[model samples]
Target: MKDFKFVSKTQETLKIALINFALLLIFVELGSLGWYFVKHKQFFYTREKTQNKSDLGINLEGVRLNQSIVERFHPFFGFIQQPSADFRPGFKVNNYGFISPYDYPFKKNKKNQFIIGIFGGSVASDYSIFQIQNKILPQYLKQLPGLQDKEFVILSFATGGYKQPQQLLILNYFLALGQELDMVVNIDGFNEVALSNLNNKNQINLAMPSIQHILPLTSLANNSLSTKAMQTTLRIQENKTKINQGLESLQHCSFAACDALTSVYVQNLVNNYRKDVVAFEKERGQNQQDDEGSVIYINKNKSVLEDSAAFEQMAWNWAKSSIFMHKVLSASNVPYFQVLQPNQYYQTKRVFGEAEKRIAFNNETPYAKAVELGYPALLSKLPNLQKNNINILNGVNVFDKTKDAVYVDSCCHYNKAGEVVFSNYVGSSILESLRKDEARSKKK
Candidate 1:
């Protein structure tokens, strides 16, 4: 009788536990379903509105889609049929619509022809400014006296976050497309160390996936929620402020409370920004891969300040790769120039003095070191090339400004004024080089 009672109790306990487990799972499933439905609804509503508007066509959050379109149409992809329409702006519908942007029509020319391909990361893309004043090289070149009548088209397709290897790959791709470019200008330095240290070979491979490429969709969704919340909070505070202002008796008291709230909000904003930077670093560290297919362990032993040598190595590696790229272009008989874009710290009075210098020292600025190296490693193949009567130009020192040329608080990319100055310098240098080359050929 005792044994039977014990067995019955055990069975009852097991049954109750199993029932609770099922109920817990059902709750979780329902919660997930609710979240998913809410997200889907939000996405649907937002996209429906955007669809009625003009389509930006390709994703501009990352690299320009024109390059991707060309890559997809490569013979390896096996879709040899011509595009139904010209996707590029200003082009009419044609059978051979998939030609390179380098091949795009410029104004009809009289006789002398020159094509210069400008390559870099975001700085080269000229995203932040108006199209006419955004990029300096092409527009500047067009203004040159000798090149005024020449057919010159500057094909700049560089995007942000591209490393030296990626730039080299792009260079090769353009060459393969049969672009007889007179000069290929490579502007890099910012992305090299960060990209190489943070991203690995596998991460790079996974990065370009069509599904994963839509990864920004998640961020866009989150940002929409955030923006909506911010607007709502601001509206409430604004209403409160107006109410307080109207009420004379309560005005002083409400003012104090409002000021305090504003202070708190501002502090929260600063804290969030700091947190974002930290989180980004952590994510990058976690995703970093090693040569043996293992995640590269970011050293927790030392702070960024303490790990000076490692940082220098990162910059050095980037410089070496840039040098390698220069050599590659030289060997291919491709005209190439390296344009150095200045960082915010490099040009700002606010960031000037010892503090900024220390930060720059810690980060290991590549252009400064490249200047010291003075074109040896960059032009290693040049001695042989001189024998063949070929020469390459270095435009790295052109935009090295002593003071901040960009907008206040911004770094690296230039503002309109800076862009104009940089483009003018580059344009003049290129024309001079072209003239020199012409003179040499004529003498020979």
Candidate 2:
């Protein structure tokens, strides 16, 4: 009778263990679902499209979103700008893949049209604080009696993360397509510095190693865990800080520790948020090499030059490309200008907002340091630009007068208010150039 009692008790204990195991599994499943919901709803902005392209008058014949830009596959430049699905401000793309709100053909309109093609990276691509083409800068400029009679058609051919050579390729493509441009302005600097130094590659078109390739997987995973633990502590401390106004925000972790956490956070955020979309959504090599003649791979056996020297060489290459483009445009008597876009890193005496402060504090990355170190090299080449007969605008100094915040989310981009400053600066410079050209014509 005692043995029977012992067996029955053992069976009861086994049943309880199984029940607890089942309950634990259920809890894990529920927690995963909750995490997934919060991640998607709070972080990702995804939309499903059921509308036909024909209804929108958009031809998706050779288009792909390599980096979230609705760009068409170009044989010469890798990709060219198209109307992006990411954001909308009532803008339309021309049939040739140029972003334009007005109904105009890709070719010159034969109306004495003063066609200006503005090319650069994302800042100049209307991916910043404002859709540059939709802004009132052009309208404001047209109101000037000096420009009232002229028909202005400003075309934007810029793309995010594009370097100077890409702009040159775009110009070459335009020249090939028989589209005449009056003044081609290239706004650059940040992308050139960032891409050049980050990859340790002197050339622009070569693909740089991704963050996953740069950082060790083991370190990334371990650091990720450490960050999460620190974040939990930070959150609790922050709550206390809120309650006690005398407490410092960085009571738990040092600034460097926080920055390390932030770097990992940004990397994970990008990995989690970016759609698992392949390049061109097809087998690679759909887009033939556009940089065949221009790209010259640096010899790795030679000792690596200092960051400044390498950056200066990169700047010189850009200047040479600009010179090549000048010859290309001068064939049609088209004037061209290169504007070195302003960056927050260059603004030494600028005030920082809360969001700006976070970005500023996280500038220890190789990419950020490269931009900071390499910018001076480019700026020092201004005399070389002048010697080449290139009318380059020093946009690096454009933000000096504005006491208000100029930068937006990133290091190089600016707010709409900042965009106004940029537009006015470029407009005034363009106006001055036009006046000089007109005066020269009168001399003839």
Candidate 3:
């Protein structure tokens, strides 16, 4: 009876200790949760106080990309801008799907319509936009003799990320369609160098479209992973989109961290998403070997990243494209001139202020290195362009004297002031060259 009492007392004590430990855990959990939320409340905005105005107040215009822009492949050229896919108010894509908010009409009603088609990549596109708004170049040309009576209209063939042969292709395609161009001014060089090297880096054909053009299409070609990934990713992305846009409202929550519980849920979803994406990519890579028919990948000659020999070949290809363009234009009796667009990467070419340094210069980008290495090769081929009877203007020194910020972006783009200087120089060169030629013809 004494031994039984001792064992029963020990069992009762163990039960009491376990119950007290469980109670302490529950107390600690509640206390911690309450403290975390209370600390957040003291500093963070409340949904009631802020009135969820962040959704309305936030301007994502600068950050928002043109993913909404629908792209379609062209037979002659790689892709043209499709009609009106952008959601921004008053912004419209042309019928040809080029960047401008205008149309390339088939019918030319005006007689002596000297349509000066501007060709090149995005910098050229910006120049076209400037010309369309200001009429700077045409005005300068009009001041020259024998060009006054001609009705000049701007036709922009420039697209973002277009390189050599694409410009040549664009010129040929339009001319084949019975569109008349009196002159062609191709603004290029940067795309020809940067994007071609990029193509080789991506292990694709140099003749193929830039990686930006092809990379988005790569995911959709995954055979088995497509259907599975699309379903899961669609749902997750839908939730993520709502969360990012602040469209999914939670009770008494603000922008910063929203609600901790909701944050936990989002984080969980993100972890699952990351896991899904990795699996999707892995399976996609494996599938590409087996399902080659789905992708337009060719086992073409690919050089390693930023090879000097490869860069030389790219510059040669650029010159050759210009030569080909000259042949086509000459056969049609149209004057063709190419302006090698100015770049920030050209060493000691421009003096960068703090603004330019921050926004326009990135030493880490492949562009700086590409320009540094590839530009010498490209510049060396300038004589090759000139030898082909192509009136090529080297615009590298366009901003040499100007201490102001000319380059707006890191990837070889010019601002409004840059545009103004470039356009004036281009216009003046064209006019003066034509005048000199005219005077020579008269003397002869």
Candidate 4:
């Protein structure tokens, strides 16, 4: 009986010990969770605020919600104007569409003629003196004998770093505002792939953070992190300062020791930027097909159009956006033309430097592949466009390297000389098209 009693007591003690251990574990877990919440409260709050302040609708004018100010202006001179000369540098917001600044507002006349608007990135926005003097298509068109009375307004609406979806958004915005346009010309290639990877879908709706606002905080934090890490690492090394000073001396110590230390420290910060980018892309969704059977990569949030199916959904999105502009102009009985700009690599493959070659392949060359896949898919849909009487001015042929061309570096943004060449080509094409239309009208 004593043995039985002893066994029972031992079992009871074991059970009690096990219960205490389990309780301890539970308490530790809860405490850890609570600590984490306390430590990251500000991060959570800021994320929540950003989410809550999400855009209600698309901003057509590229106005920022917080500042309620216009960062850029669309002037009659075919150039984007900054707020003021004294305003902060790099404050201009370029267009978010396929429109270019290659053309300017002209004196209106009673000739019920077609007015073509050109749009795209910097290639379309080439308004340098060289371009104006030699390559501006509008200038050439104005002087053409065939298009004497036919006015062609090549208003460029392309902005740097704008992607396909943003261009569509801009077209939709302008259409809503009831701007009568005849046709749209797009010179796209460089920004399509790169900006597609960024996370700024609502750029037009929100105010871009100022460079001045970011620089000071970044400098201070960088300095603090470097100072702490360096002090910790060099605490015991007697010759550490000597080595560091020698390295600094090699560069003439242009920056103070503290600055270098700060840079090293700040660069080590582990950020969730990659995670945020992934989340944004997932939210944007896949590309859609266009009327041309081309699969266009669209931000999955937008609407789909027929015949745009075969183009890379992103490319298709951009093309569809351009097509949408054409529809708007057609509805308003405004005439316009669309031009597909060539990637810079296609224009200057021979002169590319090592780094330039890599960037050309990674950044600009993919459009050619997209076009190859898109063209066959879109071939059948050409008739539908013809039915709409939309004159498609395909400039992809101009990208042929067999012909000498000038582009800015290895990217699609053309240099002054290149812009002039492209503009002249565009002008010639417009004149020919107008002459054909005149003949057709006479025959009718």
Candidate 5:
């Protein structure tokens, strides 16, 4: 009888334990649901819409895009152009990894195909190679008589954030690859001027290292995640707003404290989510600091160290590079022209509209002072550029006399009207040079 009583007591203890365990689980589920309701205020919530990775258009070399379809990596100049990246409408990368719609290995059916390669920075890479071929340069060229029937293939190697050396490297690549280019036109100034000023403190050259190497703080994967997190945060804020609106419409069961509590809770959740983002950015910044070898940031204790010498040296380097390019093209029997593109920073004249004025004179950027210090140095080398028999178009004062707005932005990126003006000048220059070449050829 005593053994039976002990067994019965063991059964009773097991039952009590099971009952308590079930109660604990029920409470946990209730708490989770309550937390969810507090945070979202809705019984059900839909996920926020996000941009597809393919939607982000192409950016090459040191330039970056929010979304990318980058596939190939180049050893020398960082990333190569992504072929057939149709991320945006009317934009296509050709098979040769250029921002062109036409297949490369140009069809040699047309003997008089006047192939010209254009190289520069963001200005050149504004849209795509196709844009230049079909729209920009062609629009101006068509207007000039006798250029209508010429089969022209304008190969663009311009990339945003690229500098002089980078542009030269791209030209060298195509030339080395046995790609036939008749004339090469380079349009640049802003990137050279801006990069030199910004990176001088780093003691690095005007051109940046590879995009991956330069921005090592955040990986592409992490950047995507950060973007999604921001989207989610926006969704959460929207939900909170909706919840507040709904609360105001309710008749009420003494919900003042509850309303306050819910608002505080949602805001706290939002704050906490934001804290994670801040932490991620901080970590990335720390990583960037750690990888300073690639970036080369030398902190000089300069209360007052003028960048005049640096600017002079940088401009000298630019001139020397230009001279070298002149030799390369001359040896190859290819005509070359370098256009010293204008910048809004140096334009003291009222060339900017209301919007352009804001972009040009924004003191937040250091381009103003850089242009002030660097353009003079660049101008000083024009005599040397002229002496070397290098064909150059000094566009620094191209818009000085014009009344219409020339620059669309402070960085001196041109608008359609601006492009028409610039391209017309460039086209006229090319035609004049070609005529001179033909005359020289006939004399020979």
Candidate 6:
């Protein structure tokens, strides 16, 4: 009888333990639900730092920020980088549709104020915003002769994937807005040679803006409608976005359960998902359409005669556009220099450091052949440009002698050292040109 009593007591204890455990789970879930209803945010969250591993040439956040960035077209200048904050730290798009912290268009142009405007594609934009503003303007350029008494203001009217006449159009657009400049620096050639065909040619008119700026608008206009593979991509993109949301809320997460390591793992999985999606889209021949409602043309005044762009025509357009820009700027007494930007495929002209070999090149890039074949066409136009009295600098060989790691990525961008090198050369040219002008004026 005593043994039976002991068994009964043990059964009661086990039943009570199970019941308590169930009640505890219910309590936690109910509390979590209550928290969500009050805050309108997920209770469980995590943190992660993003690494760009895809060669999409654009980040997903940039694509999704349609109103402020690309995926929208401007009627005047093909497309403008609408003034808005970018994801990069300390990046602010000024009111003039350029990347700058200050609204230079409205900033009081002081006496002896020297406004140096940069025009081109991504390289020029990066050079203007980062290198010129941070290093060259302060350390190198400001120390130049004839600039000692002048207060410098920078205007970076460049955009990503910009080519020839687009830079010309940007200058005209801003000048029409009554913006003034003491000097203009245009870094171009690569986009003219490479993206002209990539962005246009069988896709849109060769004269239109970069296709990077086009497809997104079409996708948005179609209301996310796409092929099955693209649908999968869209789903994964949404998942990545949600993951990013949770990743963003880590510091503010009230729950003690926000796991940083788990967040990184989740992000990595999504990154791989993105890679798979890309491959799947390619395999399935996922249709990327230029929908009927998607095309917006901006070759007003019809400067471009060709329906499709070839290498020679693109180089011609580049030369003519620079010639026109120099004429316009020269009329206003603004010195202009056209710089052909640096590219990695051209790295064969010089020996690259181990670091450059590791990070700066991808043989698989679509631009490799285009650069090899198309760059020669651009180079051929140099004598014609010089004949027009347009100040021209062939910067294709800028990294020819540098054993230092200069290029930043597989694309045509540069690192700090590269930016410094590019700026130093530009500064030297500016000094020489100013001295020559002074001499000419004295002789007159």
Instruction: Write the residue-wise lDDT of candidate 5 on 1-444 in tens digits.
Output: 999999999999999999999897667556644654564454312312223322111111122232222334455655556675663444456665556545664544687676777787767765334345345555555554566777777777776556767777777776787778777788876667676666565444445532322332224433432454345445545544543343343223133334334445544543443344333333322333333333334233333236877777768767877887778889988878888887778755545567657644556555688888888888899999989988888877766666666564445576556666777677777677666766787899
**Runs with alpha carbons beyond 4 Å of true place in candidate 1:** 1-114, 127-146, 199-285, 288-334, 345-411
Predicted model with the maximum TM-score: 6
Q: Tens-digit lDDT track for model 3 on 1-444?
A: 999999999999999999999897667556545654564445334333443322322322112133322246665677765656562333356778776555664456788667888999888987887787788889888887778888777878888778987988887777878877888899999888887776776666666666555443454543434565456556555644644544244344543444554555644554454445444433333323343555555445634644877788788888988899889989987888889887888786466788778877765566777787778888999888877888888888888888877776678777678888988999998888778768988999
For all predicted structures, in order, the TM-scores are 0.45, 0.59, 0.69, 0.45, 0.63, 0.71
**Highest lDDT against the true fold, candidate:** 3
Q: Write the per-residue lDDT of candidate 2 for residues 172-289, one digit (tens) a residue.
A: 8766777667668788877777765544532322232211122222222334323433343344344333322211221222333332333344334333222122211111212123
Q: Model 2 segments beyond 4 Å from truth? A: 1-74, 80-87, 92-98, 102-105, 109-112, 127-146, 201-305, 353-355, 359-361, 440-444
Model 6 steric clash pairs? none
Candidate 6 residue 317 C-alpha distance from true site, Å: 0.4
lDDT at 150, model 1: 66
lDDT of each: 0.43, 0.55, 0.69, 0.42, 0.59, 0.66
**Clash number for model 4?**
51
By the lDDT metric, which is better: model 2 or model 4? 2
Which residue pairs overlap in candidate 3's backbone? 81-97
Ranking by TM-score: 6, 3, 5, 2, 4, 1
- The alpha-carbon deviation from the true structure for residue 194 of candidate 5, after best TM-score superposition, in angstroms, is 0.6
Per-residue lDDT, model 3, residue 377, is 85
Q: Which residue pairs collide in model 1, if any?
A: 136-423, 344-411, 344-412, 347-404
Off by over 4 Å in 5: 1-73, 79-84, 87-90, 94-97, 103-109, 127-148, 207-213, 216-287, 292-306, 348-350, 437-444
Q: How many clashes show up per model? A: 4, 0, 1, 51, 0, 0
> What order do you get sorting by lDDT, best first?
3, 6, 5, 2, 1, 4
Task: Write down the RMSD of all candidates, one decimal each.
Answer: 19.4, 14.7, 11.8, 22.4, 15.3, 9.3
